[model samples]
Target: MTSTDAASPLDFPPTPAVILAGGLARRIGGGDKPMREIGGQTILNRVIARLAPQCCGLILNANGNPARFAAFGLPVVADSVADFPGPLAGILAALDWAAEQRSGIQWIVSTPGDCPFLPRDLVARLHNAQGEQDAELAVAVSDERAHPVIGLWNVRLRDELRQALISEGVRKVDRWTARYRLAAVSWPTAPFDPFFNINTTDDLAEAERLVALDATAA
Candidate 1:
């Protein structure tokens, strides 16, 4: 994570963020994984709290019934594609929603709903990295592993993305991102990876432990 004191100048505007909550969560049983609790709070709540400040505004990309997420008061959107393809479908859904719902928001950042420990400077650093590298897109990296789903996207490419998804059947995120100029921003993993996501019961238990550690550190 970029230190607050050493934060670089960001030339881009504050990008809106979308929490991709439209996962089956088969590992933890079929239910909203973000609705699961960590440290007495819902994972979605922790995700929202962490990201709301960094974004211009926030929306949730979730399929199925939107009523379950009504308590959060965020505009929940479903996938634009017909079937559940992958995170690419969620990203495309958010980009289209941002274009229609949010005026003047040309760019957006995507984060997984189960990742409650996102870095504070996530959006700023993404934009900064994209600008520095003169790239068209950027994704977060930690401990040399790329979190492709968590990325900064240009809303203007929504139509192209739709074409890639529906017509070309492009489902893989890295395959799509590879077509564009991409920037990778690395963060330290000494403490914990900011992109740590819960995929199973064991992962959720680990997240609880991490949350306790964070509270104790604070």
Candidate 2:
């Protein structure tokens, strides 16, 4: 459904969320893009602030030493697949983690770590759209572009995803999602794109500007 659709009062169970941060970040230099600063706060900090209240729990999907994220106090999970297959691998890791640690949770939401201005209603909107459309998966859309990486995923699909990544070599999120009854939920990009991500030094500067604009508006 489009962002112009009427709002619903429906409430849903809080789904667990995973922040995908395992990218190589070659364009912005080889380090965590979420660790960069915007308005004196790290992008990762901002992402956590927006997502924590909307989720039952949060986990960071990052490779290498988990201790680097110790201060965040999140359970850092590495991809189970070899050679950093891509964001799908991170999603797989999250699904496995949720199944093992949160047996009662049947679904989880995933977002890129670089997106600091994620919509507060992301989880609720995705779940609502998925239920209304009878979709097996739901992804966020902004400015008419589908963001496959930022979406709600069914936990039971972990095994299938593992097989796709390991056996079939499926690395693109949209490719696997294409196999499901997918729903695209749209959000407004007017005031600012809630899905805006930092991919380069210029985008970091723009994020700082957005932060200033947000503070002024507040």
Candidate 3:
């Protein structure tokens, strides 16, 4: 993993963030994965807590009745695409929303809602790497594996992303990102992977254990 002590410029503005929760969660019994509880708190709650401080604003990209997420008081945006394609759809929905709702914002950060321990420095590190490399986009990497969904996206690319998804039927994020000057920012996975996400019942149970371990360490 690449290491860096460099911080984002003090004048740099916080980017808007989108919590992707549009998945059907078939592996974990077909419900909202972020709504699953971990250490008495929902994963979505944990995600918001971790990201809210780092981002300028938070938006939830989900399908179904928005009322289900009304408790969070965030503007829940459903995918504009007819069928739930994937995270790419969610990212596009967020980009559109950001463009319409947030004036003058040029970028947005994205993360899977299921990840409970997203790094606090996620946005800063991504922006830092993107700026340093003079890349058009940046993604998070850990232990040499890139987490495509966890990255920073330029809002201007929304049109291209929309064309790729709707017209070309491109689904894989890496496939689309490969077309750009992308920078992969790495994070250490020593104690535990900060991007650890819940996908199955087993993974959820493991998340509980990790939460306990976190409390014990604290």
Candidate 4:
């Protein structure tokens, strides 16, 4: 897998989506960050609303309190490897889950829980980049930054990823992506940046302000 190549929309589903909700949101006073409200709606609801239309199906990759997400109408998978293994573990979990769901789930799209403004065309764009390439992982790229975890990862590398998690102790997003034929799908940045994530209270407030602005503009 070369560093320059990545998968695009020339791919298909049963490609399920995995929302990486495993992180402990210590910055927002320790409750569920996805459940935090902005503009009369919970972030979780907004995320599902946006993501539901973009992929074949959705799952929350969270460990504790999977029952709280039962209303979402999708499976909630825990990290099968071990100890807060990060987004890569979530990706592996999603892949394994997809494999169990059907025979030909070649791809999976992922996004962060706190990113309210996730890409609307994420699945299509990533799938296009794949374009029949094997071992390729497609990811979103905007403003010269690669959102590695927000990606379309092929399920063929699931066992390799499991080994990395258990044996090699690899945790970084880029490290995992580097192991594949990675490609970046360029998205325009000014009007929308899909990788926007809310980590602090100030960021949430700003998102609320933006939501308000969007409402007025509409």
Candidate 4, 1-218: lDDT as tens digits: 22223323333565678888888888888767888899998888877877777666789999887888887777899989778878888888889998887577777888888888766667776776778554388888889998888888777888888888889999998987787788787776655465678889998888887776555532
lDDT score, candidate 2, position 182? 100
When 2 and 4 are scored with lDDT, the better candidate is 2
Which parts of model 1 are misplaced by more than 4 Å? Answer: 4-11, 216-218
lDDT of each: 0.88, 0.89, 0.89, 0.78
**Model 4, global lDDT:** 0.78
Task: List TM-scores for all candidates, in order.
Answer: 0.94, 0.94, 0.94, 0.88
Residue 130 displacement in candidate 3 (angstroms): 0.7
The 10-residue segment with the lowest total lDDT in model 3 = 1-10
lDDT of 3 by residue, 1-218 (tens): 12323233343565989999999999999988899999999999999988887788899999999999999999999999978899999999999998998989888999999999887778888887888899999999999999999989999999999999999999999999999999998888857888899999999999998997666543
Kindly list the per-residue Cα lDDT of model 1 for residues 112-186, writing each as its tens digit: 999998877788888888888989999999999999999999999999999999999998899999999999988
TM-score, candidate number 1: 0.94
- Give the lowest summed-lDDT range of ten residues in model 2: 1-10
* Displacement of the residue 170 alpha carbon in candidate 1, Å: 1.0
> Model 4, which residues run further than 4 Å from truth?
1-11, 132-135, 213-218
Please state the error at residue 185 of candidate 4 in Å: 1.2
Q: Look at candidate 2 and give me any clashing residue pairs.
A: none
